[model samples]
Target: MANKTAPLTDTEIRQAKAKEKEYNLGDGKGLLLRIKPNGSKLWLFNYQRPYTKKRAVLSVGSYPEVSLKQARQTRLKYRELLANDVDPKDYKQEQEAQAKEALTNTFEHVANLWLESKRDTITSGHFQQVKRSLEKDLFPSLGKKPISTLKATSFITLLRSIEAKGSLETVKRLSQRINNIMNYAVNYGLIEVNPAQAIGEVFKKPKKKHYPTLKPEQLPDLMKALNTASIQLQTRCLIEWQLHTITRPSEASGTKWSEIDFKQKTWTIPAERMKSRIEHIIPLSEQALALLDIMKSINGNRQHVFSSRINPKKPMNSATANVALKRMGFRGVLVSHGLRALASTTLNEQGFNSDVIEACLAHIDKNEVRKAYNRSTYLEQRIKVMTWWSEHIESTSQNHLLTTKKSRLKVVT
Candidate 1:
C-alpha cells in the first residue's frame, strides 16, 4: 500500500531552507509549495481534468501569502469542482476573464451607448434633458459599477436623494430611463436580465395637473386685455398668431415663414418641431392670415415668423407669450397654453363635432384607425370649424372694443 502523504505544518515550512535545486514539498490532496533555489515560494494545486483525465495545475499564490490553511481551503474548493465534473483550472480561467470583461463594460460606458442611439430619434432639447438627468443623478454614484451586476438597490439611494427634494416626477422619469438603458443592454445580449424594472414603484407618484385655463365667459376679458396690455407689438402678434392657429407655444414660436402657404391658406408644421413628432397642417383663417401679413412686414426677411428681439435670426423665446400673459395682470388666471382649452370649451358649447375640433388642435387619438380616418376626413370640416372659430374670435374682439368706452387700438405696430 502507498504511504499516505502527511499534512504540512507552519513549523515545518518555517524551518525548511532553500536548496541547491528548485523543489516542491507536497501537502495532502495535490497542494504543493515550491521553495525555489532563489528562496521564492509558490503554492499550486495539481488536478486531473474532468472527462479527459488530463493532468492540470492551478497556481493559488506564493507561500506565506497563501498560508497552509488557505492552501487547504483552495484544495477543497478544487475538489468540489472535480466532483461536479468541472475542471477547476478551466473554471478559474473563465471566471478571471469574466471579471476583466465586467470592469470594461461599466454602467457609464453602456449608458453612453444608449444615449447615442437616442441622438437622432428624439428632439435636441429632449435629448439634452435626458443626458443631463443621467449625468446629474445616476453617473456620479453608479457609473463605475459593472452593468451586468446592477440592481434596483443600486438606484435606491440615488432616487431617494432626488425624492427628498420632492421631485417624484423626476424619480419616476429616471427610473424609466434606467429601465430603458437596461432593456437596451438586454436586447443587445449584453445582459441576461434587467434588475431595474420595478425601482419606480417604491416612490410616490406625482399628481397630474392640467393646464390652467379661462372659462368660456372669460374670453371677452382676455381679448380686451390682450389689446391693451403693455406688451410689445411682436409679442401681441405672436400671441394672436398662436391663438388664431390654435398651436402650442414652441410650435408657434418656432414657426418659419417658409412653412406658410398663402395660396393653400395652410401653415405646415414639420414632424420634428411638433410635440407628437408628426407633421401638422393648420388651416389659416382670415385673422391668422392677416396676422402673418403684419409679421411679414416686420420679419418677412428673417427665418422665424416671430424673431427674437435680441437675435432676429432665431425664433421667439417660447416663454415670451407666458411672460406677456403674466404682465397683463392675467397671472395665475390663464397661460398661453390655456388659450387652446378656452377655444375647446367655447366650441364644445357651440355643439360642433368634438372629433373635428380635436383634429384641428392636433391632439392624437389613441385609436390608430380613428386617428388615420380623422386625419384624412376632417380637413374639410376642419376648415369650416376654423373659419367659424376665427369669426367667433373676431366678433368677440369687436365686442371688446364696443364694451370699452374708449377704443384702445391694441395693434402692436
Candidate 2:
C-alpha cells in the first residue's frame, strides 16, 4: 500500500524531523528521509543501477538549502538521467571534480609551466621563439579553452590555418610544440591524451624533397639588392648570414655570442635547440664572421647576437628578414629561405662535394658513411667555399653588375 501523500509545509517538515524516531516518512518510490538519533535530517535517494539490483544511496543537499522543492527537483533530474542511460550521481560527482580542477588547470597555467620547465634546457632565443609561435599561432584560437576539452580536430584547424599561409614547416614545428605542451599536461594528469598527436591524420604535409636552389651567377645581384635596400642592419645581416651560413633563419636569428668561436671560425649549434636535435658545427666564412663582428658593436652586451631593434631582450622577429626583402622591391624574387638553396646550388655547381655542402648547411647526415664517421661539416672546405661565395658577393654588390642579357635570356628560356 502507498503512504498517504501530504503537501509539504515548513511546520509539517519541522514536525516530521522532530518526530522522525517514531515514524519514518517514505516518499513511496525509493526516496526516504532519515532523522538521525542525534536529530539531524538527511535527504537520501535510493536507486538501483540500471539492469542491476545493486542499490545505491545518493546524498541530496542538506535540509535548508535543498528545501523540499529543491530536493524533489534533484531527484527528478537524477531519474531523468537514469532514463537516458546516464549515471546522474556519478556524472554529478565527475562534473564537480572537473569544475574544481578547471579552476587550477587552465591552458595558460599549463603552458607557462611547460615553458618555464624548458627555459634552462633550451637556448634563450629558442625559448622566445616557442613563446612567440604559441602566442601568434595557438593561443589566439585555443589558449582559453580547458586543456581537457581540446580536441584533435580543433588542433588540426589551427595547423591548417598556418599551412594555408604557406608555412608548412611551421605547421609541423607548431604541431610538435602543441604535442609537447599536451604531453606536459598529461604528465600532470590534466589531460589523458595529446590531441596534437592526431595532426598526421588531419593535416596534409607537402612531400619532403630538396628546397629549390638559386644559381651562383644570380647571387651577386641578389646580395646587392638586399644590402642597398633601406632595411635595418639586423635584417641585412640576418639575410646575409642565412645565405653565407646556409642555416635556417631560426638558427641564424637565435645565434649567441657563446656559440661562435672566432678563433676557430666555427659556430656550434647545440643539440637541444637544433631542429635536428643534434649538435651542428657550422664553418664560418670570413664574410659571415665579418657580419657577426659588425653586429657585436650593436649587440655586444645583449644575450642574443641579433637582438631586436625595438627590444634588445628579444631576438629580431623571425620574419623580419623576409619582410624587409619584400618591402625592398624583391617580392617573390627571393626569400630568406632561398638563401639555403642558393648556397647549396652554387656550391654544387662550383664542384664542391655534395656531402660537404650538405654538412655546411647543418643538415642531418643521412649518408651512411657521413653519419658513421661524424666526418661531416669539413670545416676547411666549407670555409673556402663560403669565402669564395663571399668574395663573389662583395665584388658584385660593389660593382652593381647585372647578369648579362644573354644569361637572363637563357634563364627565361
Candidate 3:
C-alpha cells in the first residue's frame, strides 16, 4: 500500500531548503512545490491525459508569485477538466491563445483595418481627413481597449468631449465613423452589438450657416479689388479661374496642365479630384482661354497649373485664394467658397435652368432615379450658359473700372 502525502503549508514551503538534487514537495493530488538545487522554487501540476492516461507535468508559475492557495485552486480547475474527459494541457494552450487574440483585437487595431479596406474606394484627401480625425480624436482614449468591451456610454463620452470644443459637426462625423467600426466588428463576429448606433441621439444638432457671399451687385468691386490686390499673378489667376469656372477651391488649386484642352476649349476634372466622385467637364470661355494662355506662359512646364512657388512639384495651397480674398479686405464679406453661392444664386435668379446650373456646378443630384439618366444631360446648354456667365463677369468688371475712372476725374476737376 502507498503512503498518502499531506497537503503543503506556507511555513513548510518557506522552510524547505534546496538539496543537490531537485525534489518535489507534494501538496496532495497532482500539486507539487518544486525546489531546485539553485534554491529557486516553482509550482507544478501533475495530471493524466484522459484519452491515453499518460502522466504529464504542467508549470503553474514561480513559487510565492503564485501562492500555495492559488496553486491549489488551479489544481481543482484541472481536475474539473479531467472529469469532463478534457486534456488539461490542451485546455491551457487554448486559453493562452484566446488571451493573446483578445489583446490583438483592440479598438485601434480594428479601426485601422477598416481604414485600410476603404483605401482604394476613397480619395486620398478624404482618406487623410478620416485618418486625422481618428488619430486626433478617437484613438487617444479608446485605442487600447478591446472592441468587445466598448459600450454606447463610452462613445457618448468621447463625442461630448468633441462637442465641448464647439465642433458639433465633427462630433456627428466621428460618431458615424465609430458606428461603422463597430458594425465592422459585428460583421466579423468580434462583437455582438454596435454601441455607437444610438450615440447621435445624445448630441445637439449643428446649426446651419450659409457661406458669406458677394451679391451680384457686389461682383464689380470684388473683381476690381482682386485685380489690384498685392498678390502673385499666379494666385490672381487662380481666383479668376475659380470664379469663371465656378469650381471649388480644391478643384482650382489642384488643377493640372494635362486636364486642360486648349483645342477643345474645355477642362475635364477627373472623378478623384471632384467632391461628388463624378467627372466634371467645364467648357472654357474665351476669357478662360486667355487666362490659360497667360498661365501657360508662366507655368506650362509645371505639372500643376497653379503650382506652388516654393515647391514646384506640388499644387498651390488650397487656402491661397481664400487668404488672398481676406487680404483684399473681404474677410467677413466673402470667401473662396462664397463664389459658388454667388454664381448659383445669381444664375437661378436670372431664370437659368436649375438642371443646367447644377450640372455646371458639379453638384450631385440627390434623386437616385434622375441621377441615373441625367449625367451629362445638359452639356450643350451648359456650354452656352458658361459662355454667357463669363462674358457677363468681364463686362461687369469693365463697366466698374470705367465708372471708377470717371468718378476719379470728376474729383480731380
Candidate 4:
C-alpha cells in the first residue's frame, strides 16, 4: 500500500522554523516546501516522466511569493498534465516558447516586414507616404498588439476614430492599407482571416473633388501669364515640360536624366515609378526636346532632370509646380494637374482617336488580353498627336501675344 501524506496549512507552514540543514514539509502529491538553513523556503514539484517513468523536479517559485495553497494547486496542474501523458517540464518549455513568439509577432513587426518586402516594388516616395501614415495614424493604437489577436471590431473602432476627425479620405486609404496588411498576414499563415476585409463597407464614401482646370480657350491666357511670370528658368521649363508632355506633376518632378533617350526621342518611366505599375513611354516632341536641351545645359550633370535647388541630389518637391501656380495668382482657377485635363479635353474635342489619346495619357487598358497583345498599339499616332498638340500651344501663345500687341497699339493711337 502507498504511504499517505497530510496536506500543509498556511499557519503550520509559517510556524515551522528552519533547521541547521535543508528539510522539506510535504503538501501531498509530490509538492514540498524546502526550508533551508539560511531561513529561506522554496516550492518544488517532483514528478515522473509519463513514458520513461524517470524522476524529475520542477521549481514552483520561492515561498512567501508562492503560498502553500498556490504550490498545491500548481502540483495538481502538473499532475493533470501527467495524467494526459505529458511531461510537465516539456509542457512548461513549450509554453515559454509560445510566449516569446507572441511577443515577436506584434502587428508593427509584421507590418514592417510587409513594407520591406515591397521596397523594391514601390517608389521611395510612395513607401515614405505609407510609413508616415502608419507612424502617425495607425501604429499608436494597434502596433504592439499581436496580429492574430486583432479582430474586425478592433479596426472598426480605429477607423471610426479617424472618421470622427473628419478625415473620410484618410479613413478610406487607411482601411485599404489595413486590409492589405491583413491579407498579407493571412497569406503568411499569421492569422486565419482578414479582419479588415469588410471594414471598408462601414465608412461613408467621400465626395469626389476634381482638380480645378482651365477651359481650352483659357490656355492662351495661361500660356501668356506663364511667359510673363517672373519665375526661375528651371521652374518655367518644368511647367512647360509638364504641359507639353501632359504628365502628372509628380512624374514631371521626379523625372531623372537617365529616363530620357536623346536617340529614341522618348522618355520611359519605369514600372515601379508609374501609378499603373506598367512602363510608360512618352514621345518627345520638338518642343519637348528643345526644352530638354536647355535643361541639360543647366542641370545635365545631375541625376534628376528637375533636381531641388536646396538638395540637388534629390528630385524637386512634388508640390513645387502647384505652389508656383498659386503664387502666380492662379490658385483657385488652375492647378498643375489641370494641364492633363486641358490636354484631354482639347484632344477629344479635336476628334483624336480615343485609344491614341488614352495611350498618350498612360491610362491602363481594362482588358488584360488586349493590353498584353497591344502594349503600344497607338505608338505612331501618339507621337503624331503629341507633336500636333505642342505646335497648337505654340501657335495659340503667339497669336495671343500678337492680339495683345495690336490692342496696345490701338490704345496708343
Candidate 5:
C-alpha cells in the first residue's frame, strides 16, 4: 500500500531539520527529503533486493524541482514493476551497463567488436563463412588502416584486385561488405563519408552470368528427390521460397519469422541486410505462401526460418544449402544461388519485356532524363511479368513444358 500522508509544509520541513530521525522529509514512503540545517530538501529512495542482498539508494530530485506529487509517481512506477515479478533495480543496472558499453564502442573499436560480437549472434559455421571473406580477403589487406584515411580510389583498387581473381560475384558482394563496414564506421562516428559510395561507378560490373537451371524436364524428379531427402527439408524450403518469389538466396535464408507478413503475402527486407541499401518488397507467389505455411509447422518459434541445426537463433550457414546440393550429386548440375541467374537469363531469352525482367531482379534502369524523372519500379507491370515467370518456371520444372516462344525485353523502369 502507498502512503496517504499529507505533504510536509515548509514550516514543518524547517522544524524537521532540528531532529535526527525526522532529519529527512518527503511525501513518498521510500523517498527521503533531506533538510539541510539551514533549510534545504533533497529527495532519495532507499530499498533492498534479496538476490544480491544489496541495499540501493536512488535520488528522486531536489526541493521544488521534484514536487511532492512528482516524486510519489516515480515511486509508484518502480513499485508496480516489482509487484509484477519484475526487478526495477536490475533493469536499471542492465540499462546502465549497456549505456556504458555503447559509450566505449567507438567506430574503429566497434568495427572489430561488431564482427566479434556477431560470433555468438551468428553460428560458427556462418562465422566461418563471413570470416574467410572478411579476414583472408578483406581485413588482412585493409583492417588496420584508419577508416578516415580510406579513400574511394583505395577502396576501388582493393575490389579490383579481387575482381582480377575471376570472382566477379565476389567483387559485387565485397562492395556490399565494404559498404556495410563503412556504414558501421559511420554509426561509430569514425568517418563522415562512405568510401564505398558510387561503387557501381567506381568498378566495372561483370556481364551478368547465367545460372545453370534445370530444364523444364528436370523439375519433377528434383522436387521428388527433395521431398524424400531427410536432411534437406530446410534447404528445400529455402530454395523453393527463393524460386517462387525471385528473392536472393541470402535474403531467403535469413528470413526472420517476424519479417513475414502472411496476411499480405509479402516479405519486406530491411535495407541494412540487402545488397542495395534500399528496402525490397517481394510480392509472394502462391507457391511461396504454401512454403511458408509448411515452414511454420516446423520452426514457427525460432528467430530464423532456416536456422542452423546447432544454433536456433541465427540463420543457417550460406554453404549449407550449396553443400547439400553437392552431396545430392547436383554440384556441377545445379547451384543454390544459380537459381537467380537461371531466372534472369531464361526470362530474357524467352522474350519478356526487359523492364519486367529488371524489376524481377530488383535492377533499376537509369538514364539522364529517365533517371531524373522516373524512380519507381512500376509495380503494376512488374507484378504481371513476375507472376507469368513464376508460372513459367513452375510449369517447366514440373511438367517439362518447354517453350521456345520469346518476347523482346525492353528495359523501361
Candidate 6:
C-alpha cells in the first residue's frame, strides 16, 4: 500500500526556519515552501511537463504574501491546466506575454492605423474632421485602453458620458466610429469579436432633420431678393454660381480658377473637394460662363474663383452663401444647401430624367459599379439639364425685374 503525504499547515509554515543551506517543506502534490538562508520563504509549484514529461517549476508567489489557502487555489488551477495537456510554466509565460502585448497595442494605436488606411479614400477635409473627433472625443476617453481587453460595457459607459453632455449627435457619430475602428481590428485579426458592435444600439437615437428648402413656384421671389439685396458682388456671384452649377456651398465656394474650361464649357470639381469623394464634371451654361466672366474681372488673378474678402489667397467662407440666403429673407425658409433641392424640384417638374438630375447633384450611389458607369453615361444629357436650369433662373429674374419696374411706373401716375 502507498502512503499519503500530509499537507503542510500555517503553524508549520510559520515555524519553518532558514538553515545553512536552502531547504524545502513539501505541501504534497508538488507544492512546497522554500526557506532560503537569506530568511525569505518562497512558494514553488514543481510539475512534470505534459507532453515532454520533463520536470519544470512554476513560481506560485512569495510565502507570507501568498497565504496557504491562496497557494492551494493556484495549485489546483495549475493541476487542471496540466491535466488538459498544458504545461503550467509555459502557460504562465504565455499569459504574461499576452498581457504585455495588450498593454502595448492600445486603442489609440489601432485606431490611428485604421484612420490612416482611410486617408486616401476620403477627402482631406473629411479626413481631418475624423482625426479631430478621434483626438477630441474618442482618444481622451478610451485611447489608452487595450482594445482586446475592452468589453461592450466599457464603450456603453463612454456613450452615456457623451450623451449626458447633451451632444447626442456627437454621441451617435462617435459610437459608430468606435465600432468602425473595432471592426477594422476584427478584419485584421487583431481581436476575435467586436465588443463595440452592440453598444450603439443601447444609446438614445437622435432626431432626423432635413435642410430648409423652397417649392418650385417660389423661384422668382428668391431671384428678386438676390437682385436687389444689399450684399457684396462676390457674395451674390457665389450664390449665383452655386445655384447655376447645382453644387454644394463648399464645392462652389472653393472653386479654383484651374478647374474652369472656357472652350469645353465645363467645371471639373476634384474628388478631394467633393462630399461624395468622387470627381464631378459640371457642364456650364451660358449664364454660368457669364458669371465666371464677372468673377474673372473681380478675382481672375486670385487662386480661388470666389476668394475671401479678407484673405484673397484663401477660398471664401463656406457659410457666406448661407448668410446671404438668410439676409435675402430666406432665413428658416431656405438655406444654401436648399438651392440643390430647389433646382432638383424645378428640373424634375420640367420632365428631366431623375437619374441625370441626381448625377448632377453628385449624390452617393450604393452600387459602386453603377456609380462609375453613370458618371460618363449621363454626361451628355446632363449638359441640357444644366442649361435648362440655368436659363430658368436667368429668365425668371428678368421677368421679375420687368414686373417690379411696371408696378413702380403705375404707382408714379
* Counted clashes in each candidate structure: 0, 0, 0, 0, 5, 0
Poorest 10 consecutive residues of model 2 by lDDT? 404-413
Q: TM-score of predicted model 5?
A: 0.49
TM-score quality measure for candidate 6: 0.86
lDDT of 6 by residue, 1-413 (tens): 87777999999999998999999998989898999999899999999999789888889999899999999999999999998998888888998998998898899999999999988788777788899999998788889999998888888887798899888888889988889999999998879999898787888888976789989998888898888999999899899899999899889999999999899999999988888778899999877888898899999999999999899999998899999888888889999999999998888877777888899999977988988788869889888888777767876685332122211111100
Q: Write candidate 4's Cα lDDT for 1-413 as tens digits.
A: 98899888899888889899999998888998899998899998988899899999898989899887788788889999999999999999998887787788888888888888888877777899999998888889999998878998998998898899889999989999888888898898878888789899999988887888999988888888877888888888888899999998889988998999989999999988887778899999878888888888888999999889999998888888888898888989899988999999988888887777888888878998767645646777788888878877776675332122221110100
Q: Could you estimate the TM-score for every candidate?
A: 0.84, 0.61, 0.82, 0.85, 0.49, 0.86
Mark the 10 consecutive residues where model 3 has the least summed lDDT: 404-413
Cα lDDT of model 3 by residue, 244-345, tens digit: 899999899999989998889999999888877778889998778877887888889999999998999999998999899999999988999999998888
**What is candidate 1's lDDT per residue for 20-57, written digit by digit as tens?**
99888899788998899989888999888899998888
Give, for candidate 5, the lowest lDDT window spanning 10 residues.
398-407
**Which regions of candidate 6 are displaced past 4 Å?**
1-5, 161-168, 309-313, 398-413
lDDT (Cα) of model 4: 0.85
User: Which of the numbered candidates is closest to the native, going by highest TM-score?
Assistant: 6
Tens-place lDDT digits, model 2, residues 1-413: 95575645656667864553534456645556666766677777888877665788888866766687777887888888788877767878998999878776777668878999987676666788889888888888888887887788878877777888888778878888888888999998888778777676556675685533456787767767775788777778788777777788788888888899989988998887676667888777667788888888889899889998788887887778778877876676677877888867766766777767776776767767867554533766666666666655555565322221111110100
The regions of model 3 sitting more than 4 angstroms off are 1-6, 50-54, 79-87, 101-109, 140-159, 185-192, 366-369, 399-413
Higher-ranked by lDDT: 3 or 6: 6
Comparison by lDDT, 3 against 5, better one: 3
Candidate no. 2 TM-score: 0.61
All models: lDDT? 0.85, 0.74, 0.86, 0.85, 0.67, 0.87
